[model samples]
Target: MMKIHEIRELIKLIDQSTINEFEYEENGAIVKMKKGVDAQVVSTFVPAPVAKQEIIAQPTVTSVATIEKIVEEPKAAEEVAKVEDANLHKITSPMVGTFYSSPSPDAANYVSVGDKVNDSSIVCIVEAMKLFNEIEAEVQGEIVEVLVKDGQLVEFGQPLFLVKA
Candidate 1:
């Protein structure tokens, strides 16, 4: 069974993270939890090495084990690409909204493919409830691809861009 303190620590991590839903099984103990709109969305990016280290070294401190994770194990060949993506950093949406690649329709895009972005770089904008939220790269690396197009409606925690870190 999962310990009460471990469960509490998981809740604390979720409350301050973009992942509203989480599930994990550790030591044969299963746990699942979700959050409402009150979940805090952080705009900072973590590099692959440090992020992976955190996942292994600090299970009780990180948001969830689902960071860029596939819920199921697949046997298809397409999964090879997914395996390759394991080293990439994914900048995800904080809320359900429209994904905009630029500040305005007439302006140039915030960051395109092959563009190098820093921790504070604004990669795109998510328009939710008439408010435009600037989504930051948070990870310093080259933008591998823009997963969503302008005016595209995206869900909360949806992957927006893949960065090669």
Candidate 2:
């Protein structure tokens, strides 16, 4: 069973964050909560409708030990090349975005197959929102494998490149 304080803390986090809903399970109890949104489409002719805030909370208990066990399993690491892979550097995404290898639509890619990169070299670009963030090589090495493709949606901490140092 979840304590009341834990539930309150979850509520506060939802209010502070951009997330509209949150749910969690603890000690055999499941809790579902959501914050209501008030979207008002306004016109120039009349007064806008007042927005009201609503908070909903629901709770239940069920066996979830099997589901939890599956989620806890560690993911298998991807094997890149046949060469000695012990000294390879895993270049991961710094933000949640779409990855692009080139600066512009018609421009050549920053790095290509068999390209050597130092710490300051820009290997790719991660586009989050309207901003294009340059992803640099943190270690000096030859690019062994490009794990992601152009315009691929990448999550935070997702591996984009494997470099054999």
Candidate 3:
């Protein structure tokens, strides 16, 4: 459970910034605050979507952009490299297999670090039962890291690349 003081502190933090969003954890509780209509703040627990409630004061359009900028931090370029460094996205082998970065043993890899890709980008190849399978990117982003080395075995959902969208 979260403490009321922590929630109040979060409100203060949100008010202090140009970014209209802030999230923090205290005492095993995760607290998130988002700017709401009319200078009011909405609070919610983690793993649940935030629900809106009427606020006494309506927020100005300028504040809305500030909030957007804050919420958009996930897409910040600096974090992109962290995602790659952390190997966050796990591209798994759909079938039991050996993973290859290229169509053939002698070819270059399908995708490499810093490659801009869309949801349909073929980032790598997986070999199962002597057949080469094209593994496509499920999300849009730049390739951050390659978790598995070429010619390595991979399991289902095993991380292949970290992408930043």
Cα displacement (Å) at residue 10, model 3? 69
User: Candidate 1 on 61-157: residue-level lDDT in tens?
Assistant: 3445542233232334347887869989999998889999999989999999999999999999999978999999999999998888889998877
1-165 per-residue lDDT for model 3 (tens digits): 766796687677778887766666768777777776476654432333548463343435557786677556645855886555675555556765888888877888899999888888898888887788898898887887788898888766566777776
Q: Rate the local accuracy (lDDT) of all candidates.
A: 0.83, 0.81, 0.73
Compute the lDDT of residue 20 as modeled in candidate 2: 70
Tell me the deviation in Å of residue 121 in model 2.
0.1
Which regions in candidate 1 have their CA more than 4 angstroms from the true location?
Answer: 1-79
TM-score of 2: 0.52
Q: Per-prediction count of colliding residue pairs?
A: 1, 0, 6
Question: How far is 84's C-alpha from truth in model 1 (Å)?
Answer: 1.5
Quote each prediction's TM-score.
Answer: 0.54, 0.52, 0.46
Query: Number of the top candidate by lDDT?
Result: 1
Best by TM-score: 1
- Candidate 1, residue 51: the lDDT equals 36
Name every residue pair that clashes in candidate 1. Answer: 45-138
lDDT by residue (tens digit), candidate 2, 1-165: 767897888789889998877778878788987778787544332324758554332324344875554444422222332235667788999888999999998999999879999999999999997899999999998998898899999877888999988
